[model samples]
Target: MAGNVQGESQFDVIVVGSGAGAMTSALVAADNGLSVLVVEKSDKYGGTSSISGGGIWIPNNHHFAAKGGKDSYDKALQYLKAATGGVVPETRLRAYLDNAPKMIRHLEAKSRVRYAVAEKYPDYYQHLAGSLPGGRTLDPELFDTSVLGDELPHLRQGAPSNLLMGRIAWTARQAHKAMSREFGWRFMVLGLMLRFKLDFKWRRKSKFDRRAALGTALIASLRRSLQDRKVPLWLKTEFRELVVDGGRVCGVRVVREGREVEIRARRGVIFGSGGFEQNQTLRERYLPQPTQAGWSATPPGNNMGAALEAGIAAGAATALLDKAWWAPTIRVPKEEKPRGVFAERAFPGAIVVNGRGKRFVNEAAPYLEFVEAMYKDQQASGAKSIPAWVVFDASFRFNYAMGPLMPAQIMPDSRLRKEWLGTVYWKAPTLAELAAQIGVDPLGLEETARKMNEYARTGVDSEFMRGGNVFDRYYGDTNVKPNPCLAPVQKGPFYAMRLDAGDIGTKGGLLTNEHAQVVREDGLPIPGLYAVGNCSAAVMGLGYPGAGATLGPAMTFGYVAANHIAAAA
Candidate 1:
């Protein structure tokens, strides 16, 4: 271990973590000609953002204008007000909406980060006021990983199960056809294979790198920008505490390379280190009961509330401690990380049921809404809904991907012999047999299947109205007629997988005002302290308005914080 280093490093700005929020802050600050240092606790950069779908929900962005879509501030505000039930202040929401477009314009104009509108993706609640079929979500464009050079190896990677064969990255548009085994995707797969072959050769000399998309692409683009700007990043450095002078935060004490190091931030210390989702004690104390840290989708060794704790010790106020960005996740036996299945439940010929084998939700609802339904069922029936089972038939499996099981892929016979098949996945010749194998009531499953078949034929789900909304059908199999989201479970063998209530990250953290400055319990800004992203209380409050709700405010406030620091300078 090295000896203590006191005041050996100094910068105008210090950013903790390497997620979108932290990266955005570092980039913007550096662009303003400020010396910035980024410290990441993990071995690699990119926190939960890297593993995410990488969609940023920006209302009235330039892409909307280019696509001839009209969106107004008042209209966007109206939608946010209704969605969040006015829990988030109008000033804060306005800050997010107003700064969001500016952030996009700045990043595109000055940095390597590029974005394109997801033309087919709809708002989570399309039926609500001020919602559009598309144009609100901006997905990061595909990035060439070779651009990162030596920095490529230091970036966190997306889950192997999320990618194609652990190398190829597919866009949302291509995924539908690819997972369904459509022949059109063959050419796309071939192109990816050739690219990976070349990438593998390059990897032998350096590290694994290829064309990356989704969250990985977003982070890579930002990292490329950082490298271009020559900003310094310190990995394996943990923030220990804040250094306060005259009751104002001015620097931070950190453990760097197994030694204590004191770094001074001449301007301010921006806390974008993410949330406490990976901290089991914090999760149990703040989140709803039964929601454990093991169920979080965030990478291991995340924020763990270090920033929040430091802020609290400095007299900061906290909010929304009980909320999170919820989703449904399943852990396969062989897979190291749990996978979040967003589209599987919404696809045709599938239903999510409690232990009693009864459908409790509109399986076609958004992931957050689906998890809310799971919690409601759990509250009503105890542990019955803790591990909800997603049941499907042969036609569904052949036409759609479930968890890590791609369409048309065969499970080995040895899996069944070792009972691994029934552990994470269950398959049987009949509904009764599947229920018996999974330990659910056979009669209830039989009746449920009978009603589902009737609904499929009639093109209506009378129980939960599964296919009633545009958002529901957005992920549905459009090739299927009448009701694209409905199909009978008549074909066997059927399949079932247990899903638990999981979250992308915790939403609760240090509270900040509209300017992205950390606020004290007395409603005053902490002079030299700032917070953004999951490290701060979510600007959306407890409600998720769309697909990129989490990243929207994260990037916007990161922009807000950096600009504020620049103005102070």
Candidate 2:
């Protein structure tokens, strides 16, 4: 089960991929008195889940009661219907709303998996029929990895862009508190830094921090639970194709250690192998024009759509193959992954403009909507809008960080990395000079800045309504007057950074039914086959309802798939 084994092996359930959903499927199946095995394509077990922000958007999770919050299924469905724009079936959306909370509670009661309410996090579409400002998204607690023992090395390290100073880690609540510079954040940072610096035992092994936070915490917790359940997880095992017999998927043909191995699944084969964001061929084939594989913020080498392709070969239908979980990202030099440009755009004293030096969108919009606007603007205008510029003055440089660049007080020009200062990101003493530096029109930029100053004084964004929504104001600076997202950008020494239409991952893959069964084009379920996570057509369609929309439905469906399979004879 560890390696090629070079022969036939059998398990009650064969779960593909090692992310949150896959692990849940395996662990849950084992809980139901079935043997389970997990196969992962990458050497690391976590896939992209280890590097993600780790927010699970469960509509009515157990944590809500204790937090004095409540939600109804009908309200959740109404909001989803509006947000999803009716593209997804109502039954599928209803299934997710019904099962997500149950899944979270089941895992918490039976396994090491636990989540706390991210109290202040808001839903992406607050203006919809039913949207809560907080209490829906749950964040994983930090985990001590001493329990992982020898398996520690196999756990994936997070991208530098996801961590503080390219090394330190923080939980979602901690990150939000730190971003706002709220009280006790300094103490929290000091505690983590001291723990990291003082851990001589961990330092002897590797430079990585022993405490896993955010996505790493979630994955490590799941892995520990799987270990306790005696679920075998095979690394470097690639799903070559499905093995169907008697018109049912009975097993799979996989390549492990560069050799073919056929394994039989007595009950079912569940796919949680993520999406095709890392597959360039698929990106060019299905995605919008000007798309490139390098721009996706997903893990560098994983999710090449091999699993999705195998599912398609097995006659699983597909939908939304061209859509992605879009996010505005920046190409940070020396970093392996693109850093998502979240929160930074929502801060005051910042404006995102096309190459013509005109504001194109509300910088404080949801990340997915921000990128969608970028793509739309780029298509409407030419290449000028594809690589838009985020312009800000020295006040912004001193107050907030942009991409890889730290705040001015922490990382001044003298102490900054030479490769990034003037070439990768731009800086100048005046708007026209900054415009010249970034190839933006001087007059247009000057005029835009003047209007921005006027808007800052008036506290109104007539064009895009930057801070009009509660979602935008959640990340906005409360200290700012009138509008939390607006500020004058007339200070000297303006800075600019180029943005790319990046994403957390591709949102489309094998289409599935309400029970998480992979279905054919004829809307018939494929017995003994299920798909979850980014490898399945999302339940919310093109809409991102909340912070953890991706992981929420994924785990819920994985739970759904396991139950569906376990109920079989």
Candidate 3:
């Protein structure tokens, strides 16, 4: 299966994976006059990053400055300390902060990568010290995939759930309007309809959409930059072993198309092959029970931990293996992948309940916080909260979308006859019947519903403070009177979707220092080895500060790794 190769290839830097972090590292290394080779295990590039929201939380970014937003380094550090609680060393934290702006500038100057400030997106912990309401996160501008030419088909597509009309990409803010019935929204929807109609011809030819947004755009832009640099990217290449010589990682053995090949990395090998979220063995060994591969939002075959395993075998120390970028996800029977639900839980007329049919936390809380509450519930009572139910009434079903179930969209008769949907998504004419269908205590659900309805009537959630903060209110409906997040769940024909503990990816892997060099148990750098993205232990410790927390550090550390290698060279 080898394609006309008889011997080994060589490069100054060898990067594993083709996600944002890996591509950034490769591009930066190439910019520094290093010949870099990017090898991806999967047939396509981008990994899980292509399907993400493509937000990068870079404080003091140029976009923020361009928008006249004031952000100080000291204030950013204060926020980091408050969020991480001193768990992350000041040096590593400083390295991330100092390099983040540099990384953004470098990418914009050196490549086609460009970003716009998500001016209205708030930090997850907005009330915390040094936190801004917005202006820290950068979203990649939409990219035209037509530029990729033949490589377009090989690029990993964005998550289908994130797209609108199977091709158009909409941001959360855009979706808010598009879902509304306002005159402005109607005009926008009309425009989108026309665009989709015109795109039908292109879709027929390409078999995929050409307008890439969010993470898809981020990856496509990186791919274009890499192509311009003439960097060689080998797909279907699986890293087998790190070839170490005298305690230095000098080369790697990779299996490409069923044939093994040795490639020498003269300067360094950067591992950004993602986390262990898809590796069942590592997930069992590291994460808690019931939080394995099936529950992850990462694409299939991702985060298999091969890179981490190789690093560990080479004596690299690991950290934070028990943690992940947690999110609550619902498994749709018809969909091939589990969909991560965020805004739905925060909308009025809905509530999430555990097996005991009790609301344990504020439904309007951030997704990560919601999962943390679930974890807390599980710790209190084993497996009781693993499959929590997101209960909603007819009003909610008609007003808002939940996972794959669109607002006001009638379910087909064929799917309604299935028993699994009855089991997974309980629908009943009465609250007690819905509870019974989902195998919960009917009386308990009735009582929970009664209390929630009372809260809705009064516009107050005394029990868990459902709509207490700005962050909670971000996803709430503004039109609703009093508290936007409070609405009576008294409508008949209620529904419930089973939700499980899921994650964007595992957060733990090989430990790296300020320079992004993989460190051993002895606190010494594993020479010629570096790691970024989920393949490296996160610098945020265990706290998620804002949107794009995962990718911000990923790209920054990748930049750090490449610059260090270049400086040494």
Candidate 4:
């Protein structure tokens, strides 16, 4: 039932999963004169890449060369070594550093994908030995979805948090500016809205914007390139197992249209089907305790680690099985997945607190570390921090967006749905009243607020050292002096939004080497078997160096895998 492209059971390379990494591998392999087939388990393509922020973190990128800004290999090496604590293989780290930029250049030159540097984004661990202030993250340019032709209807929609009104799209750079209410942001948004409204023809076709940005744009560009090459992307196909002959992965068994089909990959099979974060059994077995699959920001049930299990059956080793690309997210009414609270936590006039109504971690810390601190608090101090509250006041509500609630200017309390008041968000006029409504200690909440006020005045977070790093300050308001990340919660009408220890994806799966070849526990490479993306143990291990860390290594290694496959033959 699986109709092979060009009407054959064999392909030079077969890529599992249809995310950015899988598509990159397929496109690159096709460029190398190899026949390629891309398989997606779901009905739609793009995987989570379509809903993502689409920022690719590649240190020492071409932008630096163009601008005469130097990024030393030694320093990037230093930063990764410090950030990842040297648990990862040095060669694997070097492979990513060397090939990531090359992959970016190749995509721009050969494929529809185009990228521009995000100048303001900073490395999460700016204090680390080798991190840049910005320019390391490359944002994908907006792409016209019309290029995809009929494929446009099946593409995954961008997340609400990443879109303007959950319809129009904007690049990460533009989105951040508008969300922060930076200079001239209003005009930028107004122009985008006007463009969308003027496209009456596009409106008739779909409610979504024709101009794709963020993950959708990145995937759309790559998909367009793949279409040009006549690559076969099979939807509604479920990978059943890896087909092994003489201990080598020769092909894969999949169910297509309710019939089993065995497709041969002469070069190899690359698994990019993503991690098992959505599998509750795997989450309980591998990830930290008190974890819930619903809290995951990744597409539910999409990344159940079929490839990971298959790879393990093929004798592949794994590491970092307990780790994840952790983040804080808020679940909203009627939305299938939680909305990520990434940038909002760093804005001034807010703090994250456990049920004890005390600030346990720096509110502006990187999302991964923020959630890790929550678990640490829960375990070490027996604090109810798993479902910690982000408690702020009217000053914050007026100036900033919290989870699903936009700023008071755009989305006032009066506009909030009645069902969301006590569930999605909470509000009260006084500190005690707010604490009581949220079930936190009233005295503790009041005392924490008083301390925050003093800290705001002195421009110092004495306990947590917030606003002390370039990364945190980057997300802060420049108008708020002394420390951009510090502000008082003294205003009446306090507000609180619950946060979950969510993740973009899991960090562990099939272990791989520098060439991205699946390796056994004894470090022997498994011929004709490769892995990339979240299905492989993350290149950074437990460390999150900067924005787009997940997608960067995934794509870089996919390039590595493709080149290695091309060279092997």
Candidate 5:
């Protein structure tokens, strides 16, 4: 129950969410002499963004362009258009590219953000129609988390450390080889890590170099900057209603600790609250399958689709509500732990099988392809085939690196111990026994294993042609004799985990104009209302083109919205 509210408490700008978009907008507005107030519905401040890959793909940036990389406006626009399947209006793509570099520079110079290009991370479709290899993504260099002082507790960390900002290191295969043969590269990587650890340790930090820990660094820097600028961040405060006047939003009705307060804004209100991924009712209605609806790589608390719902109720145009930033994840049932096993599937030599106990699809295929196949399997006849199992042999477990398994190396030992305390799962010794434990047809499983061993012996993938792609081969261990991907699912004691369609988050929300303004159903711009991040259907449409696609657009459009607001003012 919220108390009746209101005197009109005013701010130059009132941002409704504490995500990167909202926070960036607030900081920009505040630094430009606007009195800003950021309200977050969750108990914490940073939303899903705080636990993300922490990459802002800003192309043609002056800093990056000087560092031996080149990205033209034409190239960036072409890439976006191709990635979006040509449905993305040219004007919108132009706005994103034009503003992205400025935004990157602005934040780097004015805010606490420090960025550098992910020089080695390649575009997902680099060989496709239009793509820029390294220029497309910009990630923050590890920031000084101590800058936040007391605000450190409010930050969120992603589950997997490798996906987090500034945690990139040589792969497990590369590390092993370097340590064994190339002592120079091994020492170099080890020395860099040692220096990184010592730097954090000297600062009296407890844990550093985790992916989630790295994310916390960026959030800390942002929070400290916001606090320094005196931007009021209302944590545990939820946006309940939009106070619209003359068909334009002028303020918001916020519920904080059961009290309603009306926050009036001079310029506008922005909805950066993410999608409704965790909302059971909405997911069941829009998502492809019942099992795919609830899983998330981020935290479970990111169920706020309030922005999208409120926008629809207020007659805003919506798009792609039935889709997600789709991903295929091994659903480690409710009893097991929930860290996404993408690395396991993405890693070489792993194979996914249906209940018929046969390799159904290419395990090392692109993420979207894997997800689509999972949806396709759901349409098949057998009830047992609906949720498939991702099978990997003992070779897969010990040789290849799986997601979040090495917690001591990737995440803080505490978080590793906390999240994975009792969730260690593996099966071996006999395929039949493993099948029985995982509830698959034993005969089918055995047949699948026999066929896989045949393919492994020949060093070719006959069914799926899995190692055919450059991406698949990029993660493959070339040293493996025959079929890097085909390691004879014959290892005594096979391992299988039940998997369902998982996602980074939901993908559908308010439709926005080139300026990132929320567009009405009739295609009229809803002044004073802007939406970005997962609160809007991505400009890239239904598929994630690359690793940083989500963060790339979120920051780019966020920059566009702020500039539009400033120019209008």
Candidate 6:
């Protein structure tokens, strides 16, 4: 039976989708004494942001600057200028850089969330002029999900790569070392566990999850803050349409318990419902390439571009529609998962080859650059635009961590073997035989292997500058002598996996003014409508700067949006 309500439903603000932006907006609005209602489409909250590497890049942040790190509004601007290459407007970039530190402090101090700087992480454009070497990013201190109790089930666990949920984040070297000395490692781990149970105990500041497991932490922090203030969170409810009255957005049409209900928004309607990554039609039209979409890595209910489409229907302008936040992926058919091969080039003696069996680009370059090179490869020699193969030798498989492989099957073991899944690897005693099995040119594959073997012997990668960056080396094994990226894939049986240009999420959507007010086609604000996060076009335009770049601005703009609306009211 449909739940009954007596009074007309209303709130000072209505926030759709409980991602980073939505949750931040809701918490900020409620804290400011405005009655706030947060509506989530899924049965669970904590959208994609929760399931991500929880880093937020806030360059020249006050915390870092105070700690003797070099930064300023001008330097931050200089960095962005050097990184962007003039594709995005200077005004938007300036706004994001200027407001970053203040927004971080505002959320941390005002809400239950606490953040600490990730001093070791580097900007994607560290080689670019004015880019800082490290420590401009931050992530939340682990928060206890058990505090939510009944709400725990509704708070989604982010992807396995997130380390904070109990997964220890180790580089390829650490993992290899642990596996190499299994018995001693098990004994040491058991000792640590015993110590944890007996002598060594600290404040239960929640289980210390690393950056990978931070999605739930961030969401739980926001949820706890909201619940403490008595803000209503209506989950499993969807925003159907804009309840417009006399050309102004007065409220929203929401479906709750199989009934259409109207919830009046007296202050504003905030759209934080994430982007259109799962919309295959949108992908075909905008991205125009077929890669493993990595739907398993994505939060299941992210299918609807509710915020993007809804805002567009209301005539909100959009930008960066032609580009997406892209990453190079290896779709391992054996595991039926698309693993980000950040360490592939860094792995000893591994080189990536195309369908024609030739080294394309430096395997150790940033993933964005790698994917861009692959796109160029697709255009260069008339290869299939959708799927390319990343072939490595037996040593790479046995020695290094190629990418993230989920320990468990999303599909049952029986269903994973089906040909349609497309993530399987072909192993053969010879490179030629392996190529034939995978439908590639055997001679080309042999030539590519021979060249890589020569490079491995010489310790020189003349074709592509793999392992040229500190970021690459960080993901590589230091145990490899001379050059980590120069290991030849000589050990057979060789392996090949199909790869596609997958993405974290789409960055294109509604255009907004600096204050996060959705701008209309005629350059006027959409009255009572504010959009931030993935629902809106990112402030950095088409390029992603570094890890946590997406969430940093999303949270900042979310705080900005709430403040602007509250001030206007």
Models, CA RMSD each: 2.5, 2.3, 2.7, 2.2, 4.4, 5.2
**Candidate 5: which stretches are off by over 4 Å?**
1-3, 61-64, 132-134, 160-214, 330-337, 380-386, 407-424, 454-459, 481-486
Candidate 2: tens digits of C-alpha lDDT, residues 506-554: 9899999999999999999988999999999888798899998988888
| Candidate 4 or 2, higher TM-score | 4
The top-ranked prediction according to lDDT is: 4
Clashes of 2: 0
Per-candidate local distance difference test: 0.84, 0.87, 0.86, 0.90, 0.68, 0.70
Q: Candidate 2 versus the native: TM-score?
A: 0.96
lDDT by residue (tens digit), candidate 3, 1-569: 33633369889999999999999999999999999999999888999889888889999998888879989999999999898757778999999999999999999998999888887777888778899888888888878888999898799987776777656766545665554333487678667667766886686876445678888889999999999999999999999889899999998889887778889999999999999899898888988776668888888776699999999999999999998888898776655467788778888889988888888889878787788889899898653788789998888887877777767654532444475566457789999999888887788788999999999888889999887777677677777768888899889889999888998888899999999999998889999999999999999887899889988999999999999999999
Per-residue lDDT for 529-563 in model 1, tens only? 99999999999886788888998889899999999
Q: How would you encode candidate 4's per-residue C-alpha lDDT over 1-569 as one tens digit per residue?
A: 23542223999899999999999999999999999999999888999888888889999899766877668888899999889867899999999999999999999999999988888899899887778888788899999999788888789877877888878888888877876667898899999999999999989988988899899999999999999999999998898888788989999888888777899999899998899989999999998999999999988769988998999899999999999989999999899899888888888899888889999999999989999998999999887998999999998998888888888988888898999999998889898998999889999989999999999999999999999988888878877879888899999899999999999899888899999999999999999999999999888977999888988998999999999999999
TM-scores of all predicted structures: 0.95, 0.96, 0.95, 0.97, 0.86, 0.86
Better of 3 and 6 by lDDT: 3
Go through the candidates in order and give the clash count of each: 0, 0, 0, 0, 5, 13
Which residue pairs show collisions in model 2? none
By lDDT, highest first, what's the ranking?
4, 2, 3, 1, 6, 5
Poorest 10 consecutive residues by lDDT, candidate 1: 408-417
lDDT of 6 at 278: 73
Q: Model 1, 41: alpha-carbon shift in Å?
A: 0.2
Candidate 6, 107-135: lDDT as tens digits: 78888877776665567776776676667
